[model samples]
Target: MDYLALLSETEQKKLLVNFSLMTDSSIFLLNENKELIFSIQAHNAQEKDNKSEIDIVDRDDANKGKGSISFSPNQKDCQRLLKDLYEQKVPFSCSYGHNYSLAGEPLIFHNNFLGVLLFAYPTSSTSIFTSQMKFLRQYLKNLFVCHYEMDNLSEEVVYNYEEFSLLTEISQLLGGILEESKICQIVIEKIQKTIPAKSIAVLLKEEKEDYFYLVAAKGLKAKRLIPEKINTQQGICGWITKIDQSILINTGQDFTSRNLKLIELIATQVGFSLGNIRLSKEREEILLGILDSLVATIEAKDPYSSGHSKRVSYYTQALCENLNLSEEVKKELVISALLHDIGKIGVPEDVLLKPGKLTPEEWKIIKNHPKRGLMIVKNINSFHNVITGIYSHHERYDGEGYPDNLKGEEIPLAGRIIAIADTFDALTTKRPYRKAFTVTQAFSIMAKNQGTQFDPHLLDIFLSCVKKGKIKKIN
Candidate 1:
């Protein structure tokens, strides 16, 4: 409905300047609503245009080259005339005052009234066909309608691009995330940013609750504002309500059904992400329970080493924290440390409980525990990759430790990290053959063997933790 929206101000000014020089008549543009949008006034028409079809008398003598005529319409009368022209919905020419006349043509395209183009000029003294203005009327009418359609198409393309960008960002964010609140926050924020027409929010209801509660909201305004809690509902409550979870986007001003579709897709993604997070959490708890029972079995088999696996787990976590490892890596390493010595179950009780040093035969059986532990956990779907630390915990950093003799850094990162924790706990805890070494004595022994027995980098992190008194996870 707005004519200026399709035709820019700079373009309008250029049209006015060029038309004034060419036609020397007043030209005006009006919207379908009968309001004047742009205009240009040119007074001395007969001198410049030189259209011989006009039968006119100059107001001055022959010495005065060509006299000028100025015509300005009264405000009330102009509005009334434009209203009548708009209502007639057809091309027309009519006299306005004693000397001036108006000609108007409707810019209609595909049965839609786009706007009106008007031309005003002084009337000739004698009646004439007025066919002289035919070329000017047709050209101006076509140009105005052409510009209006082009602007409409440009707006649609821009809107579509914005919608695609918003959906892309939201899709990437929802992948692999396990937080309900984070999903809700992303959905609401993205919808608000894409098309800032109406206020948007994600609301959820718990099973026992009667009403759905607000989670995140973008405020309602003439323009989109920053993300905030106008209703103050946050993500703490749980999943979204079973019914009535839709985005509020009024489709009148700058919105349409396309915007509504975008919001719907975002909400569906949020719900799916929240559901997956809850399901993953439940599975992890069950899996951890089964692993706990295995740990309990290992502790019962060797009473003196009842808490050995737990202590190693504690040390491994401290090293992970000191190294600033990601949470996923840290969790895997902790689980590996707990099950590292499970293969020791296959060793004879006599050998395990011996109060003195073992012979070469007994030592050979003792060295087989790492491979034995690997064999035990190899089939577990979740522990398949996790058994790296379990199988390689005893491997020497310099390619001298065990089974495969894998060298430094060839060892998996989990293997390198758990080795330091395993050795530290073994030295400080009392075994059947030797009394407990003091904490200082344990560190002194391990420090002498860095790079040969442990990853030098991970070793440094563990030793630093001891210095900082952070090696303190307990069962």
Candidate 2:
């Protein structure tokens, strides 16, 4: 660690002041490159009174008017002494003249030479100096090492704290999002805040495609670069995408290993989030295809209701949109509508295709279709939200409905919406028992049973939709 680089200029000056008082000799502190950072002249009552006997000269004063001082030996004797000290890598003493003596010690840490600590004094005062003065010089050297080590430790503690804080913040940000593009964007933003970089990019492999595309980027013109898809066998980003690793490159500066590790952690998190989203979407598509096939089977048995399930799905979606339901809830409603009549497959063809009024027992068998539909999809995890809607779509709004006799708000909102759509589609479509009713006739019949057969608020919304020409009247 470079202790001088870690310390402020004020701290460096304070250190030099303390050393000057302790050594009773003028002090000079230099960097590893032999650049003088600070210098102080020792001034005490004893030194002032003995000024006549010792001619003290401060080399720094020669270039006081200049912004910086350059130290070089002008004499052959001084040059030889400096060379000897450097070769020995230890402290040594030499005379500037007959009266002045200078002692210098090489400041080394971890076997690396940092700079030198030099002290100047008068030779006439050598009789006053005893073994204690030599001991003081050694003590100062050890003290400097201790101070530098402590400074380095403090800096390390601060760096670790900042790293922990940054990781905590990024983890929280990643938790609230699910979209792959949004996740990539959030990761890149957090990285920009945590580290200094000229540019950052998140490359993601397109589904079933062999190349990676730039999904998110910062500080770089992405519009032009993103169009050219990058091959996984190409550059650093491509290599990282192939191996799921992260890298840091600095053009003219060196970054710490910790910074690289943090970037890798972010990349790993983004990759995991994207994988989960893609898997979920694939599973949802499969479930939707299954529902569509089941609906098709139900329609095939009854030719008059060829497009009944599709119409109910469209109506339920329109109702959900008017109610301002979330996308997730709207999706669930659409699936429930598509599979609402799926249980009719269990009903006998004679009763299902009867052109006359159904007997009481035949009517009871038709009501059992909802419960049968529930049993059909009960084992599927994705159908959890639609199961209740399928089972209760035929149940009346009042307590007079069949099966569970669920009353009022006791029915799921999805079940209630499907109930309206199912009735509306049945009334407007030509059935075995009756010809298709006109749009006004269907609405009038539904209006007569508002509070008893349908939700009052939902009924009003459906009526408003009819008036606005939003819901197309089926022939």
Candidate 3:
């Protein structure tokens, strides 16, 4: 077994120790092959052994105790124990020791019989044997009852972890790919790994309305649920998706009601797990939509810079592709470029849309947007790490920029990439304050500032992309 699994078995030992303390005797459980699985040696047993008063029978000893220790399935006691075990189909068997003069039951498992759980005393009287046999039977009954409900929670935890890992795999495959049909199919397949569903479907909220349409489905696909408009309060699945809870169909109870509630205890658990997955997907979509809206709002403030954010985003994506970044990194770069100007929201509209040169005071307020954008993104928790790009997009290579003059390699690489994209797009796009520069003129201006404003290596890559027509210069 793995280390964690072995560590988990320690709880079984603790259980045995507690049993020993309660019964006042050493107890042990062994597999059917007679290997010790757990043990709790009694203090009194150690004392008797130290005194050398009790003769312990070693399994390998030649001078064995005559017929008392022989093993035969046909023996009267063995036959009786086997019959009881077969009849109950449970871990229950009896054994008596000639040396220690004790009687107890062994827990029979699929492979081996668990160790002998014996109670010891003297062996002089028949009445003692009769009473001890009765006590042993009751002890076995109680132990079984106690442990029947044991380890269930631990087992459930294991199942939950497996389900979580599977969901993560599905998300990695479907997230950000922009393929709706494939995303829906992959999600349905992932759900099947957890449960045997009769059918599965995804109902996306329709555009510009309070309705949901069935976009993807599996099993009986008759378009019966297609274009189905459900109120938030109607049906199990509808209510769950609306309120962000889990849904379970009841097939057994109140057939007339159509909203039957059956086996709620089992259904509730399944519903909660599925509900969590649904909520997680919804949260991702909401965050991305908010990011897009923020970028559009920033650009909308100035007619001259209407499509400037989108142009920068396109250039950033091309740069990332030329650099051969991983798919996840490429997606992150696209998002970062889109929000590079988010701080513009904090700048005064008069300064932002000014058709004339700005005064020193106006310039200072404009410069403060980068810091404000960083603060805004940091409040989101998940977007805190990406805020570096928004904050440092205007920093010069020689550390002459505002809000912490980070120089050269001291700035984050993502911030450096965004700086190049933002400058390239702004220089090529016409503004109310000034006419746009030609592609060659813009390149010349950036080349003059290389190593002083932009990283030298990134400038080299930019020139190569421009030469290869990878990044188009628009006027």
Cα-based lDDT at residue 216, candidate 2: 80
Best model number under TM-score: 2
lDDT of each: 0.70, 0.73, 0.63
Candidate 2's displacement at residue 337, Å, is 1.9
Please provide TM-scores, in order, for all candidate models, with all chains considered together: 0.67, 0.73, 0.46
lDDT of 1 by residue, 1-475 (tens): 4444444356645655565545555656667765556555555332212122232333232124354443333344345556666888787777754555666667676677867766655555213325545654565557656766777788878877877777677778888666777788778777666765456656565435454555566665646543332222433221222233544434565876676687677667676777787778888888789788888887777888889988998888888887767778888899999898888878898887788999999999989998999998999888876789988887888999887899998988888888888888888888887888888898899989998988888888788788788885343
Please report how far candidate 3 places residue 69 from its true position, in Å: 28
Give one digit per residue, the lDDT tens place, for model 2 in 65-117. 22222232323443464566567878787765544456676777678887765
Q: What TM-score would you give candidate 3 relative to the actual structure?
A: 0.46
Q: Give the RMSD in angstroms, all C-alphas superposed, for model 1.
A: 7.7
Off by over 4 Å in 1: 1-154, 180-189, 197-258, 473-475
Q: Which wins on lDDT, candidate 1 or candidate 2?
A: 2
The order by descending lDDT is 2, 1, 3
**Predicted candidate 3 versus true structure: per-residue lDDT over 81-197, tens digit per residue:** 545544454545333543323334555433444434333322333354555456655755565444543555666577667755765676566544455555667766766555556
lDDT accuracy of residue 3 in candidate 1: 48
